[model samples]
Target chain A: MKNFYKIVAVVGLTMTLVPSLLFYFDVIEIGQMKLYMAVGTVLWFSGAIPWLGQKRTQN
Target chain B: MADKSSILKRLDSLYEFDREPVTRNKLQGIGNFLGMYAGEHVAGTEFVIGMLFVAHGVSVRDMFIGGLIGNILAIGSWAFLTAPIAVKVRLSLYWQLKKICGSMLVFIYNIVNALMFCFLAGAMVAVAATAVGIPFGIEMPALSDMLPNSVGWVVTVLGVGTVITAMAILGFDALARFAKVAAPWMFLIFVTAAIAVLPKLGVTPGAGNFWEVARESIWTGVAREGQSQFSFWHVVFFTWLANAAMHLGMSDLTILRYAKKWQYGFSSAVGMFLGHYVAWIASGILYAAANSDAPGVVAYEAIGIAGAICVVIAGWTTANPTLYRAGMALQVASGWSRWKVTLLAGAITTTAAMFPALVMKLLDFVALYGLVLIPMGAVILADFYFIPKLGLQSFYAEKKKIDFNLAAGATWFIMLALALFLNLYFKIELFFLPAPIWILSLGAYLLFSKMYQKNLKLNLT
Candidate 1:
């Protein structure tokens, strides 16, 4: 279950990063890029929050 | 006097193991230090500072190389100056300071430190206000704006400040978790935003003309109207001394005390490179592309709604901790409940946030506050190392039960007076004052301690 969440987090991160690069290179429209970024943001929180504090204190 | 003593005793009891060395069992590994520094340095200030560098006309070559050298110096300061002392003592800065400066002086320092923290959090609130005002089509403050520009601006600042203050008063644990989760993602947005905006500034990714475009349109080496011209030296010194309070002023002694080894100070490099260096450059690119001093507008234009939301979260998360710290500082002096003090701090901060100049003049403000706190750091260094070597007692105030160490107090005031004299009469820029004044302060403390300690010995005899 933890691995599944970790994979989901990584995929979320990739979604956030790849679309920006794609937008930069003109491979995708910025509108699409923004949508992916927003989604990626949600996905990242979903995957990361369960593990954020239980693993270690970041601040 | 009795009341004050009781307050000091209460303050001492508020923290666990605050009055003595941290035990070995509680020491943290390097990974904790790395993550903490990385999460912290990429904050709301990056949005203002990077853009300000462009506004001040730093050339591309100067920006990169100067920032590199400056950040290296900062890392060295943390490692050599702050971390070693923290490891040797294993006590927080305030507790350590109380031993050297005595309770009265530390009380004064607490008040001054709290005011600086409040103003800093106010600046972050202003940054967040800029984004919150966006949906309302509220006019962004121009670079030259020092006052609140519109009713919408005032309302936005008040609204944002209230939320931030409430969060601070409530507790920081939840927000801290949010900050940690957001840090890596926030850093990536900075990178991607710059990349996304490159074409708007006439930089084609594959073209060999990238540098040319960057030079002409981006860094341009031309100051905007009413801004001072900056160069390699400005960038180097400003970046190096940007967090002088934390490193040179010994404030990080509180945090670094938990490190298992002094070498963990090198973990600051992650923050310096990622946030101070790259994030600054990226935000500068966004500013140059958007041609706006409003962090939200530029960020929004670069990456759309995510960019704007990032500005708001960046400001709020950073401000929450700052206001909390301010409350803690005040709680020592005021002897009030944490929530009441936090509310008072929030009021002061929110009032300051109503003005736009705090964020607009953030570079100067950062330098000024750091300069103000650094003399006490010099006193600490001198008392810890040179006092014993000079045959004077270390922690003299504690040994004698003095409530105010005249030598330490004198050192702090004289240093501030000298700094003011140099700035007002000699026209030295504020950014260039900390280094020279720090040296002068160290020498002054040593000389004064020699005199003061001898007199006290004579009196006792």
Candidate 2:
């Protein structure tokens, strides 16, 4: 269960970071930065919920 | 099994055993310290600090050199002062205080400590929300605005606060794991963001002349309109003392107690240079460009959505651990479940985040907060190192089973009064008070402890 949560967190954060990475590499236009941000937000919240929820249960 | 039983029985015999044991092996290695410090320091305050530098009117030369010197001092304080005591005692600051100052005094001090931490974390949540709100067309609090200023801002802050608060409530393993995962990516993002924007700020790529352009145009060290000028001294002092409460004030004693060696203290250099130096400079450059481009508008508008989002996440990462610590302190004080206290603390911090004044006056707030908490660190130092040499017993309250140890209590009050008097009557800067207050508290604790012990003996005699 712990490993599962960790995996979820890692995937979520990575997805969130993908747009920023693309921006850094000049593959994404400046105008599209918002798209990346929106996607990142979704991934971040999704990743956080499971990990945090499981933690609460364990405690 | 026999040894375990004997140890358990022994612990049951001594009231001290009911409290957690201060085992030496629980101390962490240097890498853990480095990751934790770096992740924390780099994230939240970078946005505010960068803006403040622009506001203060620091010069290019001053910003670079001052930041270098200041961070050195900060790192040194952690390595020399905080880590030594932490490793030696292997006890949380709360547990140590319970012995030295008695339960009643520790309770009061912990409440105040936790509240200050919550407010500070609240400000970080506010910082993060500013970015998160950008995409939703949400309004953010302005520099001069104090109240929520917008319903959107309030909702965003609450949303960010809830996530951060939940992470904090999960305890040490989660905190460490999240920091480790987030820190590396955050560091990369900061570097990449700085690089990505350099050209937009009109610095030529890879040109030998770019350094000159960067110096003159990008981080020109001049204050924006309506902002106070900060020089080399201001930058240096701000950086050095920014975490003064954590290092010199010994708040990290709780964290550092888990370090394997004093050398792990030096690992704070990762945070200092990476977060304080690199991240701060990058964010400052970003903000400067934003301000110049937008003119009379808020700096966030100029940086656009990406910059705003970065600031918000940075703030959240920093706030999460800090609020967690605050919750721990409160839990220790009130004897409430840690999760419950942390959740309550999160709510309080979220509410505090609604007020923008704390975020706007972050520099002043940090300085004042450090001043308030520093005396207790000094007291602990004096009680641990000096009292025994002076023929006074350490943990006098536990020895005598007193509810309130007057000596520790008096020392704390006296030091605070003196600090307040200096700030109010003398009109001294809050930054300068910690040194004098630290010295005074140390002397006061030593003197009071000796006198108190002697008087007690006389009563017995």
Top lDDT prediction, candidate number: 1
DockQ of each: 0.57, 0.17
Candidates in order: C-alpha RMSD to true structure: 1.6, 6.5
What TM-score quantifies how close candidate 1 is to the native fold? 0.97
Candidate 2 lDDT tens digits, B1-461: 12433433332232343257457655456776776787677777776776667666777777788889999999998999998998888777667777788776876776787889899998888777766666687755666676778888778788988888887787555654555455555565565556556556665434556567667775566765665666787777778888877887787887788788888889899989998899778766766666321111232443244445556556766787678768766655445677898898999999898787778778788888888878888888887788889878998888987757889888888899998899899987776677678789899989888888899879888
The best candidate by TM-score is 1
DockQ of 2: 0.17
Native contacts recovered, each model: 0.53, 0.13
Over the true interface residues, superposed, what is the Cα RMSD of model 1?
2.2
TM-scores of chain B, in order: 0.98, 0.85
The pairs that clash in candidate 1 are none
Model 2 TM-score? 0.81
Per DockQ, the best of the predicted structures is 1
